[model samples]
Target: MTQGSARTDLRIGQLNVAEGPAFEEFYEIFCEALPASERKPRELIVALATRSDYYLLIGEIGGRVMSFAILYLSDRYPIALLEYLGTSAAARGKGLGAEMFRAAIDRIGSDSLVIEVDSDRQDSGDLEMRRRRKQFYARLGARQIPGVEYRMPKIGADSPPELDLMVRPGGGRTHVTKDEMAAWIEDIFRGAYHRAVPREELARMIQAMPSHVDLIP
Candidate 1:
């Protein structure tokens, strides 16, 4: 297991097997950090566990949730897409979140990282915090890809909703030609976005691509 030095006063350990009733202890951390959530930590963890491709890890201090991140792998894109991420309200300024992230990077080992931030953050103050997340990825030399749409039908998305794509390239796949890129995007959009994309729109978007543009899928 990878370990990073953290504040001595803080317990700074990883969360393990928190899907059961044991999560009650960590409930306050979620309630305090994410008021928008309807249930406690354990309840959410149980629901999240049922989803395929999702992974969860956390940081705790004195039995409180100090930091946590959720990752879900795409069917076609090997990228690990970070979903829910939060640091305790009390532990915001500490290196707890960074430590958790570093541990994730170590576990994934040079695999690409991808995540979406609500473009508007209109629902919560997390938008600003999400910017910090972007900075975090940048600090690790992750590349952010703009102008990409994130449509997830598995999440019951109905439109070709657009979100910026942040990518940490690790596999060294060469950039692909425009046509190839379009095909690649189509495949992932189908897999990742599912029914959210209308078939006609998918074809139109891929077919209209300029020949010279290239992107790595």
Candidate 2:
């Protein structure tokens, strides 16, 4: 499950357990790269790694952990969600992020992979960084799932932030049907978010989806 050329020395694989030095290293990188509002508690992350459907992909080089991806594979849906992906600050610009992304997709082995990115419409001060993030994923072949007003589930005391849903469609697929999108969202909310999101909020988001969701370039 690891991927790398001899020249790069990169290695990517799933970290099945939430204990020990490896898990601690991964957690360090995770906490360093993500804001508290965007991260799950360490205990919850540990608990999730024990699930059959969760794949915690950790990337390393020369035995040092550098990147990670949190993937949720849902048995009830054909799509998988890439909930979080990050590279250590020192690992940036070395292509580890893209490598981790590919590893997550390979692990999912699904025709569709969903991702949530901060919406440009939000007044978050990091607009420039958000734009670059969207561009990064776009460069990696993801297309925005237009017409759905996506938002993250509330965490702690922070309000949910607006997000844009993107899909990396496989098998030459170009779009998703309304029903398919709704089902995927439901699966993501229940399985990935663990239903931390209220049922009414989920329904409202699903209702906002268009009949045909085009992958906008």
Candidate 3:
């Protein structure tokens, strides 16, 4: 909360993969905290079950999953997408969110801590929360992708619509061309979408994203 001191923890990274069932259950439970429309696709679950990139980072005050985070690795950049992050309903705003984010970002130091926030060209309640969230990340020295727009389409489809692709290149500039940035997102969907976000589907969505001028660049 004060600084990027605890951006991540290797404790969960050290977790054994045999807990796939538990991981899946936790994955579902974690979904409740995310915006209903922003849930991770099913393909991501399969990838998480089959691969080890997804971190079931559990935050505990006294040995409980007060909060959890899913960190998705990237193929094109030396970064980890902050993917799905949330605290338990009973645990919001108690510094648990900050600590969880810090612990994760700390491990993947210097690389971007990218996240897609809902876009708002018009200020509203959502925009206010976005402002607050941005402030939180700013405290950790992360940068938002300037001129960039983030979006996620409807489930089982590729051409729903665009939302907001907010980015935070941690403590530095993480430059990428439009083609490169779009591919970066496609990489995310293909690797860890909740359902089977096929390569083609991911490609379609990525192709639809708008270009931007990144601050870190």
State TM-scores per candidate. 0.63, 0.90, 0.68
> Which of candidates 2 and 3 reaches a greater TM-score?
2
Candidates in order have lDDT scores of: 0.53, 0.80, 0.59
lDDT of 2 by residue, 1-217 (tens): 4666333688888885634777888999999987777888888899888898888988878787888999888888677888899999998997888888878777777458899888897677999999999998999889877667777776656675788888998756777887787778877878877775566766676676678876645
Compute the lDDT for candidate 2. 0.80
Q: Which candidate is the best by TM-score?
A: 2
Better of 1 and 3 by lDDT: 3
- Candidate 1 has what TM-score? 0.63
Which residue segments of model 3 deviate by more than 4 Å? Answer: 1-29, 41-49, 123-125, 156-162, 170-174, 194-217
Q: Write the per-residue lDDT of candidate 3 for residues 34-136, one digit (tens) a residue.
A: 6656665655554564565666566544334466667777656766787766777776777777777777776677767677555555566678876677677
The lowest-lDDT stretch of 10 consecutive residues in candidate 3 is 1-10
Worst 10 residues of 1 by lDDT: 152-161
Better of 1 and 3 by TM-score: 3
Q: How many steric clashes between backbone atoms does each model show?
A: 1, 0, 27
Best by lDDT: 2
87: Cα error in model 3, Å: 1.0
